[model samples]
Target: MGKILGIGLWVCIVTLGAVYGSIYLATAPAGPSEEDAKKAALELIRGEPITIPVIGGGDVTGYFLTRISFMMDKEKVKGQTLPTTELMTDQLFTLLVGNKMVDIGNVSSFDVNDFREKIKTEMNARLGEGMVDQVLIEQLDYVSKEAARKSADGGSRPMETTTVVEGEKLDEQPASSGH
Candidate 1:
């Protein structure tokens, strides 16, 4: 009877611990506010025409130049349009391209969350205590129009290559070979 009570107590303690742990993990606080986002956006735009590079391999050349518009509190601001413009031959644009190429070299994927966080960090650095409501990519694409035209003519870019194998074939050959 004593052993049974000990086991029951142990089980109860473990269950309570698990419940609390799950609750703690589920309710983590979110970062920043809409007001903060707007402030950050405004601060970032002050240095306007921020260009970032789109990194790729093999026959891909060039970077992306981004022009920041305004930063408004998501909850407070109503009906805003993002800005867009063709690649320009401006000094700021050139600096943006160079900085982006050095910063995001050979990156294959662009996660939106990661970009937003980066923008937030940058804004914080530029405007101490002020935060941007959001980082709107307003315009994002490869900088090389020539490369884009070439890809269009080829029907597919180099990054689309993939290998496929059937389940039955996998059993007959090394898993690494796929067939």
Candidate 2:
């Protein structure tokens, strides 16, 4: 009985050790070194242009008002300037509009973060390196009479107030007069 118990204890110890070992290995950080990180940052920023389609439209031209660049550090950009610029051009906006426009109303509803992630993925693929950490939108605006009108009018114009309902239930009526 003692022998059996001893063997069982050993087996349990072995199993526990194996489990902990695997867990430690799996959760270990595999982040690149500073040098490799910098290299990746540079490579991502030096790749070809990537265009992403926008959604919704009227007879409007969309423009990226802010700088179309990703920062690795304060000094380094994630991708090359030309490609990044091209990615943020009116043409890219048009392509997005063409591909994604479900209705005119859907244009303003965009997930900025998702778009940035998409750009990052594309850039990484093109560069064959994971360098870009994020893409940021400096400014985004649409050039069109309608777009201007929408903005000026406070988004499709202020909705008119039809009526004001004061307190008191409409179900109860005042005492009726009987002659």
Candidate 3:
């Protein structure tokens, strides 16, 4: 009886060891090494900056020359989750050009965080999910038509406005009914 009990105890210990070992292996963080992570970062797909002129600011007189970039995961491209690059850029162009992001009052009045979130959300939806990892504000410049014109060759138009998005127009808010 003593021999049997001793053997049973040994088996129980081994069983617990096996279970814990397996659990540890299964749950361990399996991220790549630092070198690999850096390599992946270096190889990330960076979308072109979407530059546009924002044209309405309550009483403010200048337009926001905004530029935004999207950094996407390469795996998205490999896994067929991201669409063609041209399509992505087109969609981004449409979003920026069609956005209701005029100055409102001044640079301080524009909610960059809100705009960023909206771009991320809507862009992902347009791309069919997981296409863009981040939407970065590469540049935001505010210049009045006059300033832009002055900066140019005294005659050329301030940077020509991009073509309107093919499928959509700038959304106009309905006039409020005076109470």
Candidate 4:
């Protein structure tokens, strides 16, 4: 009877310890940011902006220069025997190539925050679930194709010189010349 009592007490103590241990682990706080390597390792995939022609209405309308950075799952990426940088950059390039000038330049029509979220969603979809949680826009710029062409043809001038008159916008167009 004495031996049985001792065994029962040991079992109770073990069970209580397990319950408390589990609760502590379950309620523990999350680790550091994705860029931190001390608490939790993170991998940064960088992409530089490149000139890409924008095709619309069967014509090249403009060009886009875009750069993106993504925070990837460090553990998973390290485990794989693949070139993580190339993989991530290719995915980013694919996304940038798919956007139109209007999609990027019309910040007034489309909210910049919404566009950022859209980029995050698209990046995650390509990189895999939980692979990328953060997307940073390093650079994004647009230039009309015509502007580049004119500049190449020794024409240097600013486009869309505007003046305000009674809360109205007035855009001055370039004058045509004939010899």
Q: Which structure is stronger by TM-score: 1 or 4?
A: 4
What ranking of all candidate models by TM-score puts the best one first? 4, 3, 2, 1
User: How many collisions between residues are there in candidate 1?
Assistant: 9
lDDT at position 137, candidate 2: 48
Clash list (residue pairs), candidate 4: none
Candidate 2 TM-score versus the reference: 0.35
Which residue pairs in candidate 2 have backbone atoms (N, alpha carbon, C) closer than 3 angstroms, thus clashing? 45-78, 45-79, 45-80, 53-96, 54-96, 66-139
Candidate 4 local lDDT, 1-179, one digit each (tens): 99999999999999999999999988846865554653265555564445666778888877765655665567666654556556655666676564652554444554555656777787667656676666666655567787778867778676321111112121322211110
Question: 1-179, model 1: which lDDT tens digit per residue?
Answer: 99999999999999999999999999856987886664554422322345354445543455454544323333322222322122111333443443443233343554556755565556544433243455555444444646545666784654221111111111222111101
Better candidate number, 1 or 3, judged by TM-score: 3
Give per-residue lDDT, candidate 3, residue 70: 60
Off by over 4 Å in 1: 1-60, 70-108, 148-179
lDDT of 2 at 63: 24
What are the TM-scores, per candidate, against the unseen true structure? 0.33, 0.35, 0.51, 0.55
Highest-scoring model, TM-score: 4
The alpha-carbon lDDT assigned to residue 171 of candidate 4 equals: 32
Give the lDDT ranking, best first: 4, 3, 2, 1
lDDT of 2 by residue, 32-72 (tens): 78877765543222221333333244534432222234433
Query: TM-score: which is higher, 2 or 4?
Result: 4
